[model samples]
Target: MEEMMRSELVSMSSYCRRYGHLKLHDFSNPSFKKTKYSPTKVFVVSSSSSNSTSPPPLPQNPIFQSFFFPVTPSPIIPYLQHCSRNTKKRKFTPSSSSGSVKVISREAFNAAVKKPSVAVKKPTVAVKKPTVAVKKPIVDVNKPTVAVTHDRGVRKSSSWVKSRLLGKGGYGSVYLATSKDGRYKTERAIKTAELSRASSLMDERRILKRLKSPFVIYCYGDEIVREGTSDCYNLILEYCSGQCLADVIEDNQGGLSEFDVKLYAKDVLSGLSYIHDRNIVHCDIKPDNLLLTPVDHRFRSNGFLTKIGDFGLAMEKGSVEYGNGCGHKRGTTRYMAPELIGHGVIDFAVDIWAFGCSVLEMLTGVQVWGEHGDLVYDDWVSLIGHSDLIPNIPSWLSEEAKDFLKRCFVKEPNARWGINELLNHPFLSSNQVFSHNGFIYE
Candidate 1:
């Protein structure tokens, strides 16, 4: 039996080495392009199950045990799994009959891998009869269900039969939920509101549906439902995990470095240009709305790919004009544009204005438009009329960054910077080969 066990293991080992590429036990290399391997099988050999009554001891578990395992050549990669060991030193590789797997000492391996305890004793429990037939409390069959709530509206809010808080909004609440039908399951954010605001929420949805871009956060689903004490509609959205650029900046304390500001600003512009091309105007663009995609913190991550989310105040190109006093201001105070207050179409220029504001915020930890006052509009006019009101470019910014932003914050929208120009700008173009892990830190 021992001879047979040795023969079988030898065959397995031979098979693994023959197609090592396909069954690479090494976990360190993620790049599959290094070799052409074809795995044919993956096996978990249990010494306890061998025909030989006296099984070999366990070896110390290797960090890259998969590297030693046999693999099947199927396209579907199979992960190596082993039951955890409690009593013995667990090892990964199979050595010769002399117990040559070097990761662990022979004594430790024997002590660690003892046979599982057997339950041979006949165990019995005394049974008792219940005096009463206890029943669970019944809920009212006709009671209304709770509506999903969220901090914001997003596509995940529109699931059916999942009456739970999906998320919360500054104006409403959101719920993260799963639907009764697994097919409908989604991680979502929903904005809740009184029935009176249904029309506005729908309007926002209409604008959101038409705008598309990889840089923009997408709406997944939506629904109008009744919340506690009031009938309301909820806007569901895709789950985005990173802090808004606002929070990221605040976390940095003083402000973003010049390089990061340019990086984030470029993505913001790309998102805007996509929306504008579709004739949609994001009336509100602020740090809260400009989002970043979360990534592994250990590795270097890009803050540059900012996804523009939350189109609640967005409008289609031909939508009716809304002045500040007449409607729900529809924008953050500081980011609101001069033309937006006049009930004019503000066009795509409003977004450009907001983008400029965001850039200033990124450079200096202050809102570009300052507070609303007599000088507010006057400041905008002067800034729009004269280029100096824009935040002073940090000396660290490149000459190209200075020119790119100068174009973005131009006094006139028509003359302002466009997406293509910004993308091709020197700041982004300079990085030929980049990686989050300092392959190219700059």
Candidate 2:
């Protein structure tokens, strides 16, 4: 019986070698009768017919062990072992059930038999962020939006909603402007002029760009905007909530108190000093151009901070032209200095002379040259230019105030005290504070 069993196993091995590609049922194991043929479960070996003693021992190769033993065996394992042991060169013909054969090269077969390499994960690298450029937006006249470049080269867009007309001048009309989007908390004054006649506004913008001082009205920036059919040049400036010194005096029903005058004079001098140091001359320095800003207790108890504004008539010190044409003066007639009227000479001293006139008006609440009366422009020119008379300094003023005005009113521009010298005067050195009686508007 044992001899018969060995013979049957030898026949089965021979049958497997002849038809390795065909599916074979395992009749010896009835339990596997219903299972389909799987390559991983079918590695079998038998003694060769020439040497029928004992079946040759399985290969000790780790590659063979990793491919076959622990899991169910595959027919490809013994086929691969045969390929590796055979000395004769033979093509590996892998067949499918459809009777088609695929010829795999020796190198491909070897590569398939070799162990697959484990994949390595690469280290992550950091990428730098890219910088973005800002593009300027197109101005929309209907929306009234403007793209403004600020101090640090940073650009931003702002929309100003125009409200009431603050005032009008020869250069342009000043309007109260508030930010439409609430980005800017404070109210602003926008001075606008038709582009064709915007020379004064342009010049003022250039001059204001160079000036920086708390006592001077600040220029935020300027933009060219379209209004209806006309392109307008707009200058954005700090808005003073109070009023001009002229209006303030009129509201008070008389000249301001000496305390108020000294307080305002100090700030004006400080602003003048800053501009004069840079060789700028404010040709117009009347009370109407000196603006009062509301302030908190930290600044002054008077509820106002005097700031110098209206730089439309200002020019660089040596570049000032005395008249436009036909012997007409550039500034208001009442504040013109003797040198400015007589010789057409203009300099920083003209500002001092006008400042003196403004102080007098603030004290008297009236024009320095009095009413026009019967005097025409030429008549007034003759009277002021040819005569040696100066504006009358009131008798009620203190000696220090009288002396300060005298220094400012000197006929010869060279002899007049400069802004620095006047700042040291006793009139401005007073430390006394006064109470404000609140503004009275007509």
TM-score of each: 0.53, 0.60
Against the reference, the lDDT scores of all candidates come to 0.58, 0.72
Itemize residue pairs with steric clashes in candidate 2.
40-73
Model 2: weakest 10-residue lDDT segment is 29-38
lDDT of the structure predicted as candidate 2: 0.72
Q: Give candidate 2's TM-score.
A: 0.60
- Per-prediction RMSD in angstroms? 40.5, 16.5
Off by over 4 Å in 2: 1-158, 183-185, 318-328, 371-374, 431-442
The number of the candidate with the highest TM-score is: 2
Tens-digit lDDT string for candidate 2 (174-235): 99998776566668999988777877776677788888898899998887765776677778
